[model samples]
Target chain A: MLTPLTVALAVAALALAAWCGHAAYRDQPTKDWHFAGMAVVTALSVLQLVVGVVRLARGEEPADSTVIFVSYLVGVVCCMPAVGLLSLSERTRWGSLTVVAGAVVLAVLQVRLYDIWEGVGA
Target chain B: MPERNGDTDGSTGTARAAGTTGDGGRRLASGPGRLLVTLYGIFTVGAASRSLYQLSTRFDEAPLAYVLSAVAAVVYAFITVALVRGGEGARRAALACCGAELLGVLTVGTWTLVEPSAFPDATVWSDYGMGYLFIPLVLPVTGLLWLRRQPTDGSERTDTTSRTGTTGRTDGTGPAGR
Candidate 1:
């Protein structure tokens, strides 16, 4: 049930997380590369939200459309932005680490979204 | 007060004092603390919504599991607030909640495995939060570890400095030391 887009997003997010985690352990600052990754994540998340809404409108039913859509919406529009802003404020290694962690969460939530769409659970 | 900079402000002056004396625990409250709070807020909303949905949809199906989800949400919410508020009292509260979260996850994880029938549905702690990729399990441990390493009073000074010579702080005294 995973779309090609989702797969690509997941890989990209994971890669960003790995890079960010490495940088964090090295006690580095929040690099421009990390911000670029977050921007990608944000863009992809918005795409996913739009896709979800379209699917719902097209009669594609999830196990719980309300919950599924809400989760996705929150993750993209609210949670991700808030985390990104806070990390920028910190401007430390831990701040970068937070971005890394948030990327991981975003990837996992994408998986969850896929499952919800397909009406399955692991 | 309005024109006073962060370092010079009398209100924030306590933070400087705390930093020098290792008592201004609020440093984290503003910086990395806010980031953590944001994450916790997401978890709080997720867990709370999930639990409420479970309860409203099927209270009779798995009361214990659903109730635990609600508890997890409350803990996340509390921790988020404590981290944002930033003070000795807030830190204490956060420490207690984080500790309880760790214990709760373990206990519920074990209970669910041993008594599957007891939990017809999944709680945040079920399967040691495998559903959440065990972040639930790891977060509290990290929070508690951070809390323990923090100065016992209310200051934010730790002795573990990096090579840069900056005082011991969470990020290892920046890249200058490295």
Candidate 2:
């Protein structure tokens, strides 16, 4: 079951990805706006991790807790930080594009997490 | 490749005005290079972490595939570092790693297809990187191509100088049209 919050977050992530891709080819500097979007996505991902664990603890059955938890944790910890660091190093429009790539990866992981929750594999 | 007085001066001034960044010794790596490096970093971390988790949990079930995943992870890590480093040393390392990756995906991808029984489950290159939308397969080729386009001396031989008339593109690729 997809929640409104999750859907909204996914949309935002996708939007960020699109913007980053557009900015990369432009060869402009990635101003603060790109970072801000990444920061927001990071916060939402953290929230999702908390909520996901809580749901699992409340006698909820998932397809595989191990895979689900790992995907969530990695999405939160690795994707955002890596993107941030890469963007800073870029110092160009491509920096923003890096952020966008991270967002898309994060969003895909989010979908994978949801699939894990449903236990479709089971 | 040769160092200039203004370039060694450590200012975006006459150095960049003369056309270049990070000292005239360094050439314009370009926005695309940066973007490509960023993507490689993401994949490096993503693939490495996933492989580690998979290996730690179920080594017994499919040792061959999981081990290959770990190898792929290491290769990606190497490539990421090389790409971001972006110098003579880094470029050579990156090209080598990219070449390895291309071979790996192709060989493993075909091996998996031919001998499905050998691999109980999927690896990163199991189906020619179907899991990653074939990006894993394509990235190496693209990386090699891009690296070839750059000067081998690890200097910014062509900065905005060649494209000065069109200042629209700072990297000398083309006008970005921001």
Candidate 3:
């Protein structure tokens, strides 16, 4: 995993979380504009996922087991889209809160992803 | 179903239900239930994945811990499913499951604390889920509070029966419907 990119992704996820939290505070559901933010973070995470996969394919070794690392990589990519869709179905401030949950989770996952590569806690 | 369904049994909810009954409909996953589901789903994945990896690669290192992690994962999964299913029955099941989760966490947390030597390594519920920021301890308590606040079908039916004088609460103003 790229450390800089992961950091950037985590920052973006937190930004999205804040944005969604604002919407939830305002008693509004996540609107189209919020989804644009979701797309950016999701795209970046997916790009990171691709990079991680390519590295694995080239027989580059992470600091730990590939399975744990890859699961987290794949899991990061799934968080926003799943939550975004789920939020779409909800149409309320809680829907916005749902996005907040998703974004925070993704941000945390990003940190974990970085740690896995750094073997910080492995 | 709105997460902020405060005074849900009062006249305010009766008035409010007129507007949101279509979506929330008193389902378990409506309103704040969505938040609970999100949290529980995340925990399920975290606990399940961790336990699976540990059991596969290092069971001998901490068999009890790994098994407890798996058990916690299962309880989390059951609660998630119950919330999503969303009904009086589902609510009751989720309520029961949350009770079990709290019991498990307290048991495991206390066990690990009282007999530190018994747990060579940490499980999710160790020290009351300290590794996970005590979320394991906090989550079940939250789930239980939320689930208890939700009006069951029978209670809602009794409520509606007196007010609406409706014979079919199954389709009419819900004992469960928002």
Top lDDT model: 3
Q: For candidate 3, lDDT tens digit of each residue in B1-178?
A: 2444233223432343233353232546655666778889999999999999999999999899999999999999999988887767777778889999999999999999899998998999999999787889998988887776555543342232112122222444334443
Classified by CAPRI criteria, candidate 1 counts as: incorrect
- How accurate locally is residue B160 in candidate 1, as Cα lDDT from 0 to 100? 26
Model 1 misplacement above 4 A: B1-23, B30-39, B154-178
Of the native A-B interface contacts, what share survives in model 1? 0.17
Question: Model 3: how far is B164 from its true place, Å?
Answer: 26
TM-score, each model?
0.80, 0.78, 0.83
Candidate 3: stretches off by over 4 Å = B1-26, B154-178
Docking class of 3: incorrect
Candidate 1 structure lDDT: 0.70
Chain B TM-scores, listed for every candidate in order, come to 0.72, 0.74, 0.73
C-alpha positional error of residue B24 in candidate 1 after TM-score superposition, expressed in Å: 2.0
Error of 2 at B93 (Å): 2.0
Error of 1 at B92 (Å): 1.3
Native-referenced DockQ of model 3: 0.19
Clashing pairs in 2: A63-A119, B26-B156, B27-B155, B27-B156
Question: What C-alpha lDDT does candidate 3 achieve relative to the native structure?
Answer: 0.79
Could you give candidate 1's per-residue lDDT for residues B79-140 as a string of tens digits? 98888776677777898999999999999999999999999889999999998878789888
> Taking the tens digit of each residue's C-alpha lDDT, what string does model 1 give over A95-121?
667777678777787778677766677
